[model samples]
Target: MMLFEKKSPYKQLLNLFLLSSFVLRIVLLFHPITTTSFSWAEIIKIFLTGFLTDFFVFITASSLIWLYLLFLSESKYTKPWGYIIFGGFLSLLIYVACFNTILNEYGGVLPEIGIGFVALKTTFFGLMLFLPKYRKHIRIALFSIAIFIITLIIIQNSISEFFFWNEFGVRYNFIAVDYLVYTNEVIKNIMESYPIIPLFIGVGIITAFFTYKIVKKSMPFLEKLPSFQEKIKSTVGYIALFALATFLVPVLAKQETSTNVFTNELQANGLYRFFLAFRNSELDYNKFYKTLPDNEAFTLLNQQLEIESNATSTQIIKGRTTEIKKNVVLITIESLSADFMKMYGNELNVTPFLDSLATKSTVFSNLYAVGNRTIRGLEAVTLCLPPSPGESIVKRKDNKNKFSTGSVFKEKGYSVKYLYGGDAYFDNMEDFFGGNGYDIVDKKTFKPEEITFDNVWGVCDEDMAKKAIQTMNAEAKTGKPFFNHWMTVSNHRPFTYPAGKIDIPNDAKSREGGVKYTDYALKQFFKMAQKQAWYNHTVFVIIADHCASSAGKTELPMDKYRIPAMIFEPGKEASINPILMSQIDIMPTLLGRLGFNYKSKFYGQDVYHPSYKPRAFIATYQDLGFIRNNILTILSPKQKVKQFDLSLQPSKLPVAFQLYYDEKPKNTIDPTLVNQTIGFYQTTATLLKNKRYQKK
Candidate 1:
């Protein structure tokens, strides 16, 4: 211990470096408060997670490095403890540098723990190299630990996800695969082969023994350690160099690429934005990208916005829609296109039950849906809000702020209930529905006999329908007119028919078999409804969630978003009124028909109302289109415009359509209308964030 020796300058430099790095990380955390909004709880969680993760990683790496060096050193010219102190300082600096760089990139650090994990791995390697002889042992031990920790974290987070899948199997199979499939394999393996704890411990012990053998053969420890002053000099120099490198690499890379940190943060937290940025990797993005909107699309979208904004807030007078509100039972069919039904001019006898029901119901021959997904359809029908361009309304926390039909009915003292076979939390649907005054009945609430959790995505449509009927009957006993929103999941892709059902030879890739099976399930639901006491008074409004596959258009061609919407009241005479309509029109149309006096806070008008204009708006990612009385305006991302006159000439589009086909700003509607339309869109967008119709 050379107490008289001069103190190393390296030690003072290392201390300064750590202090500076800590202050830098603190600055990075506070920077996002001005640009991005994060709750106080969220910010604290981020800081704590970052602090704990880095602290443990540095301690672990330093400890392993020090132990290896102690055993693997020969002369001990450098003290082993000095190397560990250096490693610790280096790891801590690396953590801060990486954390700050990523935090700046990802608007906020809270959601991007992946960066921290990656940095930790890099730090482990750097520590192993601090002393060449000890590198072999450190590598083996660290690799084992890294693999175990990552796997454990994945398994832990997947527990709730797996439980939901086991409870609701095979539902929406074609839609999106659930996390249960991954954990289910692990669970099965755990039961038959190995327990988690023993497996981890076994790996750890093997790694430790292998490391020990390698170290023993490679190098021998020195009998006497070096002077303390000399050790301090070596440690401080190593730390200073590591700290300098950490701060420079990221800055240089970012500068050379012309990419800043803010965009990175946007990608981290903004799901849709991230999805768009990495669209090529996602199956949904590839399918949806083929439909980005052109200038004409935006123009048409703006027109719909104008229609909604200018139309009186009292567009549908109160008491206008009560004529048919006699305990309404609504069914949202999955992937059911209007073109598939025999009544709608399809050659296939796919939906005989729906056709029969339509014969006695007030069939809306020209109804439309706003968006192309289930959530979009639900939002349009229940809330009467237009789907945001290329984004899910459910993902937006402020969705409850948007105007909704549920709020209207709830205001009228009607009990609103929503029933789905899947996890209502997937798209935050439960919170949205619950916030809008709907009693949500999801898979968790279903009875054992009422539902079979055989689907990975959700419960089967048949089981969901049966549950709906039961709930309706129970609610009927209360004497309160109820509005029930039922969504079908069996018709989604990867459709699995019930056992012993007729199996169509539709290719595994073909959705035809699932569609056929879903039709059969729909039939079963209606057949049961006929025997229920609420049948006569109940207004069964049926609408498809979205189109399955449009044969005529690859991108939206004005009719891509077309779906059937009908009102079926048992024992009532049959009537069909065809008008150009869409998902936005459902709210105003339904409210008007039911004789509700409420003014719709929607972008749609009643097709039946004499003064109401007949228009339809459809969107596909960035693409949008407008349809009126007999004219259709098509817009594409390429700025191509195509117009068709449905009245005088159905087959041929006008040459002038091609003139405005590019639909440049000048070729579209007048400037005054454009500004007015754009203004309305901005206003409505603001309303969505304001929580307008939701009860505080």
Candidate 2:
């Protein structure tokens, strides 16, 4: 096709940009795994709204080339300095297109190599700027290189988006942002999950084809350049349109055409959604969500507190006794949801060890994770707080010296520790957990001989388990009660572990394999623990950080947040507690059973307390959900509050329930329930903002 006139090379490039986006976005929309059946009207609306969203992103993205071309006269374009500087950037892209992918696939990537390359390329390119004789030849060479690099990036992003959608069922969100922060793990994960090299080289022939077409179309540009005045006249619309798109962001966001969330998500542009997610990554609760006056909120929350140390005066208290206190070992497993267990309807037997262990443990049947991410889980179980909107408290600035579950243990004379199998610095865990007064044990603490199996996420679960046993044994020798909080990391993407350890083959490289292998490791740990002197004295608590997948037809599928929670001790009661509780409640409930009594500032309540209320907190980056009386109330940004019917039954082992929007919010919203929800979150935001939750 004749994309543009011979005189307008910029127009040809611009046309290709929009056309490719349309093709790629539509391909994602029609992807077999992600898409659900929709009406023809919904399809057209998705296309129309998505096009508008893409146009906004294009205006902003094209500003890169737009600004480059605006002042780029023949004199500037012909300069040796310009070609060499631009070529330096193209070199970086080439490094990423080839070398970066390979390094991630094998094992790990070295940032120091990239830094040294940058320094070397700068010196080499600087010398070229002095040699004016090579300007024309270098400029032509760079043009071809630029075309090739751009096409490679386009193809790479398409493959990544399709795979990301297949996993998460939406465009780029906060989770993708987190992946960007930890590129080494994310890259290795993508490489392990997919055949990146074969796919890239095989599918990359299209890159060469497009580069040739784009090069041929731009050949006329070398002969003669447009005059500055003509360029200004031709590109005036670009500036106007860019400003208009920027202004329309908030206005266009309110235009929701479909009731089905999946359709609305499909209608959105990936880059635009990413920009929105980034912009609101750390939202201030009082500013974004519905709230009440601090005094009134605190009073309402205090009224709802249960009797005997469950009050919220100055701090929160779950129980009032330290008589049953013993050495504690809390294991927070990664992405291990209730559905993965055989008792919760998983016939695959991925969690056979946990299933068998549950028979003699205090298994909570309806425990809901407060949020989707591991950081959120850590925040809830540690601080025992409702997720404080936006970033978890574990990652936020000024999260130190707080009233955490660890603080309670320390106050009760137990030596406390925070343990992880991965680098604690990944999610700011090192700072958060360390600042709050706990002996830290992460991948950095592992010695050369200590490592038996390792991957992008650091040591495997078995090694970490062995390390935990060692740490506990050391504490036992000290003759002080120990409270160890250990986080596992084997059940994640690109899930590889020590070979021949489980019934599932290691070559599967699947989530099932990951779960089963982690289960095997847990079993091994217990068998060895039985031989230890402190085995009977220590109370073993097992739970998941969060569910594996949080994607569903509705925003927060009630089932996706349900995880297995069990407390197994040698002579402890093994009854199944059928109460609806949140991840935040796990620690407090355990403490209650242990008879822990300390001044506290946590939102978690002891389910065993006589006056304890049955509620669960669930949330995403944007929406804050409070569930009570089978109704779900979500408080969102712009002071938006909505309610839906959850119809959750405590008797059900795992609640596979969806949010029914068809039900009237008025019917679901009890005035007292709404007020309680608002008061709980509003008071939390107030307390955290003022740093009032600090340890005395």
Candidate 3:
């Protein structure tokens, strides 16, 4: 008759699991990964609605364990079921523990731990086998330990997810797995630079204690087994409940996809996101996702690319021919959004040097970056291709030896080098560039004495510029037209620069400060270069990797993707081009400027070419944006198309209702624009998925 008497242990365990899962979901709801801020009322609504999906997933995931327990309740092996459950739970705990620890240290999951993890699981089971007499006591101890471990892991994963989101602006995806290749370097950097180990351990212990106490209290039903008839009834009820929870609940409570990426991501659970990432890590545009007929898609793409009908998918486009082979220096500045520059109407004066240089250079007034991430920008400029779904080609398997920009330079007998202020291995930059025939010059190549300043990213921008000059000088000795790509990292978060270089002090770290420091470093680099012999022969091409702020109400905010691009050749007349261009166009455009004729598989056309059209391709991870003839079209999953009139002046605000698609604007939709949008995105997806970007 007591509250704790004659209760079922299985029911108690299920209650504990549900309670813990709900708590974890509630905590994550409060701490959203997106930059978009929500009001208290909005947050509550999202939490309440999102709970439906979360509960469905939790029940589905735990159903197997519940069914297993039910089966054991009807068998003579019921007592030993506790030991089996303990062993299975312990194995899962060990795997998650190792996976999370490795991810924290190395920024990825390590597959090499599988063998060792299996051995550890076997040892735990072996120990349980020898303790048959103490089975009851061991079960209680193991159950408590499992609950504590799971709680600690949840807290740890939540913290890690926050940091990951802060840097990349999305939940962890398959691209994160690429970091495992540099485990030693990542671990070393974490140990030497970050001092948060003690804090994590302290918080983990406190959380585990509280979680254990709650779990122990939840196990109030623990007395005895039911009679055969009672068990049969309970089993049938559970099976029916399981079927409803697993099948019907998911269908009824599925989360809806929204036009706002932030909202869609907010609705997602971390475990769900991780599972989705793993499931679609290698997507087939034709089979897994939406697509068009191959021939039709290719025909559309060929027309857009202005290729011959008989030409093969990978057929090279022979661009303008020239006798001169100029030394090219491509500078990709990090987080240098166009709006940050004075030329773009910003009054900050943060990039005075770049602003002044823009006036003297062949500046492109309307250039859009292909995607938000640095890797995406890199892929666009180097491969001159459209953004593919999932991860960038740079991080994908067998991504090397393609017809990249470096391959063009290498074929032309130029010394091609990919220069980075940070570890090129961080995002598979080293592998991609090296595999494409570019010699890698990164932080590892720098001497200790050569580094005047440094941060977690790598050597300061000034030091990197100095090293670049030294490398180019050596390359010049060989009398080869060298192509050097200097990817700057000073304009990144936790921005630090050498003292006394800029008006903004190192202690006053901010985005404005980072921009100013980056400008100062460039000014210094040009000053130092002016004295060098290669200054006059070399053509300096300055472009941004991507914009700093990619978040907006619109799916692909054109303003955010608009970046400054200028080709600076000494003693040449400066002219501004107002044509809309994409980042992928830069390579072919550069080649045309140098008058170099080469067989290229690039989808980007030279802006100066007679056949060139003023258009841009922009995208989020999942949504594709195409702009042409003053119209903007967005192609999203499920074959949804949204179009808008983007003829409004860049300096002016869009009419309130004209920003996105809504019920009121549905009548004004243009079928032509919609078709054009679908054509471009579908074709691009087909090309990328089929690896048609490269010629056979």
- Identify the candidate with maximal TM-score: 2
lDDT by residue (tens digit), candidate 3, 304-370: 6766452233545555765468899999999888888876678889999999998789988788999
RMSD of each: 15.2, 5.8, 6.4
- lDDT string for model 1 (1-696, tens) is 111122221122222223322443344334422233445655554444333333322332233343333333323224666566556756665665665655556665543565565566456645655656876567546534543343333233223222222322111121223223245433542433334577657545644554343333323222233345555664565455446544543332232111222222211211122223343222232233223223443344444433333312323354543355577777888888766776656656667667777777777766666656677787778756545544456645565644577777777778989888887886568987887678998898877877653465577777887888888888888888898988887775556556655356533424566677677777888889889888877777888988774312123433446677787766768777766677777656667767877655666666676665566666543445555544455443333444444433232432211111111122343333333333333334444544454432
TM-score attained by model 2: 0.88
CA displacement after TM-score superposition, residue 394 of candidate 3 (Å)? 1.2
When summed lDDT is taken over every stretch of 10 residues in candidate 1, the lowest stretch is 656-665
**Compared to the true structure, candidate 1 yields what TM-score?**
0.58
lDDT of candidate 1 at residue 683, scale 0 to 100: 36
Q: In model 1, which runs have C-alpha deviations exceeding 4 angstroms?
A: 1-86, 89-325, 505-509, 549-555, 629-680, 689-696
Sort by TM-score, best first: 2, 3, 1
Q: List candidate 3 segments past 4 Å from native.
A: 1-45, 61-141, 160-206, 219-257, 288-292, 311-322, 452-455, 496-500, 503-509, 647-669, 685-692
